[model samples]
Target: MPLRSTRVAIGALAAAAMLATAVPASADDGGRQRHVNHVLLLSVDGLHQQDLAWWISHHPGSALARLADNGIDYSNAKTTFPSDSFPGMVAQVTGGSPKTTGIYYDDSYNRALLPAGTTNCATAKPGTEVTYFEQLDKNLNSIDAGQGLTGLPGSILSMTGSPEQVIDSAQLPVDPKTCQPLYPHQYLKVNTVFEVARAHNLVTAWSDKHPAYDLLQGPSGNGIQDLFTPEINSRADAAGDDWTQANSLTQQYDGYKAQAVLNQIDGYDHSRSVKLGTPAIFGMNFQSVSTGQKLPTSDGQPGGYLADGVTPGPVLADALSFVDQQIGRFIAELKKHGLWDDTDIIVSAKHGQSPTVPAQLTRIPDGPIIDALNKAWNNAGHSGTLVSFSIDDDGMLMWLSDRSPTATGFAKSFLAGYSGNGNDINGKPKPFISAGLATIRAGAQAAAMIGVPVTDSRVPDLIGIAQKGVVYTAGTSKIAEHGGDADTDRDVPILISGTGFNRSRTVDQPVATTQIAPTILHLLGLDPNELQAVRTEHTLVLPTVG
Candidate 1:
């Protein structure tokens, strides 16, 4: 079935054009004359580069296939480690790793955070660190907090989402005991592409799953000119419901946000706040692909699962087809609005799901891991001090509450040679925190397994990486998942195409999502160095220009 479409009744093109805000140009920086005026970055969450390749090949001559014909495909591109959505998106905009960005997952232990508002961390004690990214706002009903469908966008095609709406209900980690709620815009430690564009007077806009993604605003002053988020995580009670189911609502909401970008191309935001005239950088993330990749259909259908060497099932095919159709619609709209020639449409994923092979999927409950952790603490002689921790991405992004060096030292020593006492659900007895002395940082042992230095407070201490394909999942429904050290978990397809992107043909050199921000800046004739994180970390940009 095709994705349902509901186009907003936009005012005449003339009115939109009248609202067009000119993108002020910087004096020619004496480099290649850049003509790329707009960027449409579509992140099809949970899409693997291989999956995209499969879909395009199957459809033969589809919109995505055409995009590949004219673009450079980074076959070896990888998402930053801790491949959770939080770090994944941050890497794209910040040009930095968790080491610098300080985000590990949607919910991770943070030594710096404190509770905000009435949402208390029941697990957090007076002297302990903070837990961040708890979506505490989901506890409300439509009428509970004056939030109801009445306030939702009348139509996705008509208005850009307010970044505020997305974060209003999220229970964010705050300063310890300060009750200062952590706002998305204020959480970023690095400047984002949106911020840099705003600094350069280039109108910018974006569409994401939730407002908390406003964290993309980074340190820039209201960097995003038009921010629209559908709050995919929200659910309203029956009294608050307008007949739309939450899942279907999220898909529809995603479409509307994507349409917001289409509206920008038409020279205005949905609300006609002003003539946006196509921001230099704008794009939307499609959750349908991600949702379909992992979930069963409402009527219970075989969803998109890639069994070793097998393509997505019928249900998944629909999702991919919908995504392709949306891209086609976007491209058509861009052409209709005369924005195609100078635009670049880049497609990538926030993270790839796991069990690329169906049989490799496992359902080892988190109990074994948690039990083993406490056991390790007991063995370390800290039996009385039960420290808090979070399984930030299946051990790949583990975080402990105790930020002290003593805790760090204990974690390293314990996990360096941890051997679970038949507690693993694998029945045959799975090992704990695998590490090899031959690996780098032999001094830190288990700490070196994750490659983060012990002094990095924002990172996890005790590393718990399961063997490739052995997922430690607490849920029974999700068989294939990501967020680990598995090779398939980290690798994602990255295709770069645009009038301004002066590169063609694939490059095998190892590259990461971190290069995206600086590359976007360079494409716009802006100084890539303006992204401080990239400069400080000596990150490399993809070879894009002449």
Candidate 2:
């Protein structure tokens, strides 16, 4: 079955062209000619380089195959460590790792901030978990995030606002210095490609699963002029299925965002009601692929592979096909609107799912690990629990109640000796943690790995990288997860198609997704140094791109 079409009626091409904003020449352009007037950046979250190669080879003449045929495919591209959606996406726009971005994960700890709803930031207890996910939504269960005039999901297609307008301030982390809610943008320590585009008088736009993606607006908080976010976590229908629950439902949810991109291509706002013209930089992320890699179908067909783990299974194959069809639609629309020649399509993933090989899989609950750590702390005569917060998947990241060397060392020692007593995905007696505890990095070492200092408030006190195939999940819903340094989580696909790309070329050199930010600026005739993170990290543009 094909994805449900949510095409929005757009105005005439001539009218949209008239409304199109011109990209002004920047002094920082340095006489570099712009090869593409518009750049469409799409993150097909959970797409691995291996998966891209397999898809193109198996499905010749498909959208992905055609893109690769005309673009430079970076076969060895990797995302950042602690490879969660937030940090991985941020790395693409900021050209920096968690160190410079100060973003470890969506739900991370900030020692300098107060808990949400703390009115008196100056007097409230410091150190709180900063959650930038659907929890911050006015109503996560509603498709419009409960911010639209009407309750129906369709009403948001013409809505003119963003999550920033509906986010409850009381739910955001309070900055002690400002005594105000620290929005996602404010939490970012550096500028983004969108900010650079905005500074150059170029219009920018984007769409994602949740409003918290407003972080893409960069530090200025207004980099994206046409930000459209319909919550993916919102209930899909009367059946109560959500985007994450089933692959089919995820495709339906992704269709809404894909239609918005089509509207942008037709020179209209995401709403398709306003003729704002095609943005200089615009695109939306696709959740279907990610969902397929993680969740089973409604029919109980599991996600991932069939033993080998390289070849996609039935549920995943359908997801790959759905995304390909969407991309085909995007290309057709761009040509219809005469924007193909002036446009470039950049496709990559924020992060990839783990334990592709079924034999390597082990599903262990995290409750035991937390309980063990806390118990160890108490046994050592600690007055309070040593663990302040933790987010575990294929790996574990923990914030400590006390970050002192002694406290950090004690916790690390305890975890190093701790053994997994959980079962595998099939309920077999397998170590949940396996031998992964040996790779734990504590305190200063953990921060140093990401190029941050020990004093960095957002740095986790301990990072435990799981052994291959060890997923810290007890539920049967998902076979895999991200947010780890495993190859399946960090190794992702990256390809740039359209004008000026080396046709049918492949680059196998090890490269990081952080390079995508500088490349975006470079492609648009803007200095890469314009992005603060690019300059700070000395990030370079991708190879073989002129």
Candidate 3:
């Protein structure tokens, strides 16, 4: 079923109708507005807060600047640790973090069923758990078999390898003949803002550059419309095509996504009397900039190098500008359709890129660390010791056997040795490694190191933390990357604007991406605490409605 066609279905039609009528009016008794009927959530991949602030303040002609001037901007919005696209987006929409959602990185270690003291951590696998959308689908399944969804079709076409093979050979899951959705509703374990809005009979639409929509695979129980890029299907198809047409592949795809948003608007406008009354929510993501294999220029040009002559060039900047233009167009269209007043526009990013500098590379001898750690475990007869160590973009995560009680001690000793041997950049002593064991006992320490955080559950024995600006190098590429403790990767911009929102207000308090979902619910006058994964600490009570 194509994602565009799927409509929200309700089991109790009469109850749904009553709820729709009961949708809190935007007006208070004093004729003051109290609700935000529409929300436009936009995600710009690889955007940094500093970059956004710089462009907005310096380049008044820039679309972002215009938006910030007209809306509320959260200057200190930050993403969760182990920042990456998958986890970042998940946190943005789920109101949960890696610790709660169990989505730490793009690829994480999973050892749920493994035995303790097993040094074979190499056998651990990646996670494939339920996500936010899945929970909604199950809850709404009684409504109907919501097929012909708008976004699913495009996603399927794109996944069939129409343009290029997206997943590496090792990353491809087992073939499941049916069109696999990149935004598999099943993987999401919590209720999203979309679900909450739909419960009130509000229409919702999303456009994103990330694969969340394309990767959706499952019965969409909530019946929300999902319009996304198409995916390539078969191995033969994956091997037989050039998915790289500048105009047709990239530009056309972006245009189509934009059209999806417009179409939803049109549908709602035609069906409802008011322009803003049609779709209760609309969202779109622009990703042309991050596609550049290289960086953008520093002089605001398309392909120039950084001041240090190391980071990505102007190609990134040019791409971002292009996306900015598209955003301007989108806003213009909204105004054209007279939906500007009621619609709330939210702009943010998944993560930021690190400058790929020569001095960033740091290599610590893996042999000594791994050998000593393993020997210690083996000598203790922790036969179940499964140890898997890999170099991350900025640090190393070692999965020890589920029995290594001394995992934290060993990890500290290893870092000490690495620093003592001058393996660290700038020869600075490495101290204070972040470990999960601080909250657990000896047995729990072993479990945490293996990628299991929950007690009586499997987790990593020891997780390492690297200093900022440090990149762990294992092979050819000297590229600067994320998945570290750097503020650059972890910090992101969070902007919210719309009806009932505080106009031109800037919040200086620190906010995490995980709080977005619950905050959205709060803004809509819904119970955010109802979601099991919601973090009370992170949830911010906006001045809007509730």
Candidate 4:
């Protein structure tokens, strides 16, 4: 669909909703009065809390430090489960967990949706119903018609890359019958925050690394398929330049997205001031260090570049510096446009990455575990590996088929015999399964044997911990990976700043990525209790509104 017509239609729909209710604002309404006029949501992928602290303490005058000094810092922010891009991003936006949002990982198991006997990552889809920003738009529209005020903008801009790439990778081989993308946005069962914003006649914009902008263009019958505005921008492509240098590439992409946002803020019709609002919300996803997979850099490796064994190479350090500069520029532009004082800026990350582990270090052999398990299951007349297996950060989760009664039991028994025990890598005492079990009690015992923390809902049903220098692989170049039961994969930084925020206050309370959406909503004077995505008990205290 043409991007122009898409925007026009969205604008017209919002205008019509506004005109339909030419009523005066009321004070006694159940909905809280909108206190926040502008919100800027920024997501920096692969950012750890230590990285933030290091930037603040070591790199004075850095953009991050400025924000930290002026904002409230939540030191214990974390991603809920399978700490990968898709799940982490969904958790951040939806304010929900995998169990509720249904976005468990970059690729998740969906047996009923796909053909039987599928085990590959390329064949997965949303196993349950989910919802995203599109739904949020619809709700916002409902609010506009019901209330006198203009609704919020439900637009989303992301640089995380294409949802299509993620969906395609999750599925097995494409089914010859359907001949369509296996995992589409239609699979999401709930509404996203952006959807709510747009329904209220607010302008939304996004800039990111992926084609996410294009995928989520408009509401139903509006424009883009994903219910986002404009769909996407082509600025992420670097002409004749490799994206491996973290500093160089991050600076370029961040500057590009930041400029796009500034453009909208500049063009906004602020003359009407209180009459017609400008772009209400803007978000950007900066992806550069992730490209480090193709670059020759290490987290703590020596011999490249270092001071006192801390190898802060040009690749890593430069990228950090570049992103910091872009952030400073973004803030400057906001101030130039006279929106800095009123706008609330949030800086956070989707997830953090651990250093790469070379394949030669461990020398583990390629095993026939999948084939053996499949053959064993078929021979047992149990419909062939009913539980699809995939390796996650720290362990392997076996997604069982709803139809298979003994699938869980079969998985428990099959995983019991693996040689690598959980505690071997970390010196922490953890159980190692030597063979499979026949009962649920035995399954529990098996899990305990492997040192897998049972309370973390995000942990895979079956767990495996790689030795310190060892990383499991499908023989690909993605040497550095996450999704493990390790500290490096779980820790992320959350920085909240701007407009009624208490500056320089550090809170050490444990907060997960899932808490962010609700926090933002609450800060904006929206009742987060209305959204099913928010946990009932998780509430963020914001600066009081008059």
Q: What does candidate 3's lDDT look like per residue over 1-546, in tens digits?
A: 111001111110000000000001121112233555566677776576766776566568877776776667877777765565556666666666555555544333344422212334455442222222212121122111122234432433222211112322122221122223233344344556666667777765565542334222212335244434332111111233212112123444555566556655565322122243446655665544333322222224433224553343556555556667777876777778887776667788766544333344343333334455556656767553335433244544444444344555654554444432323333444332231111222345434433344453223344455554444432222234455546666667887765454456676666667666666665555666755566423454432322
Every candidate's lDDT: 0.59, 0.77, 0.45, 0.45
Give lDDT tens digits, candidate 2, residues 1-546. 111111101110000000000011111222435578899999998899999999999999999998998888989888888788888888888888777788777777788899888887657988887878887888878778767557476676865546698676778999888888999999999998888888888888899878888888888998898898888877877788766777877888888889999988998888888787788888889888777777634447878787888999888999999999999999999999888888989999988888788777776666666776777788888877778777777777777888999998987887777776655556677754333543877888887766677898888788888777776665455667788777888889889898555478888877788888888888877788988877777777887777
What ranges in model 2 sit over 4 Å off? Answer: 1-34, 149-151, 433-438
Ranking by TM-score: 2, 1, 3, 4
Tens-digit lDDT string for candidate 4 (1-546): 100000001001100000000001111122334457677777777667776787789877777887877777878777654555556666666566555555544434343354323455354652421112222221222212112223211212221222332222322323324534333344443445555556666665555443322322322211211221211222213342223333344455455455555555664321112222345666777665444422344333321123321334455566666677778877887788788777777888766654433221221221334455556777887663443434333334443432222654665566565544222122333333332111222234333432333332222344344334333332223334454334455577888777455457787766677666665666565655544555432434322221
Query: How much is the lDDT of residue 409 in candidate 2?
Result: 91
TM-scores, all models, native as reference:
0.80, 0.92, 0.65, 0.64
C-alpha RMSD (angstroms) for model 1: 10.1
Off by over 4 Å in 1: 1-32, 117-160, 165-170, 176-179, 236-250, 271-274, 296-298, 375-385, 401-453, 500-504
- Between candidates 3 and 4, the one scoring higher on TM-score is 3
Q: What is candidate 1's local distance difference test score?
A: 0.59
What lDDT does candidate 2 reach at residue 91?
88
lDDT of 2 at 331: 98
Candidate no. 4 TM-score: 0.64
Global local distance difference test of model 4: 0.45
TM-score of 3: 0.65
Cα shift from native, residue 477, model 2 (Å): 1.7
- Tens digit of lDDT per residue, candidate 1, span 334-435? 889877778877888877876556555444444444456556777867744333544523333334445556765665554456443322222344343432
Pick the TM-score winner.
Answer: 2
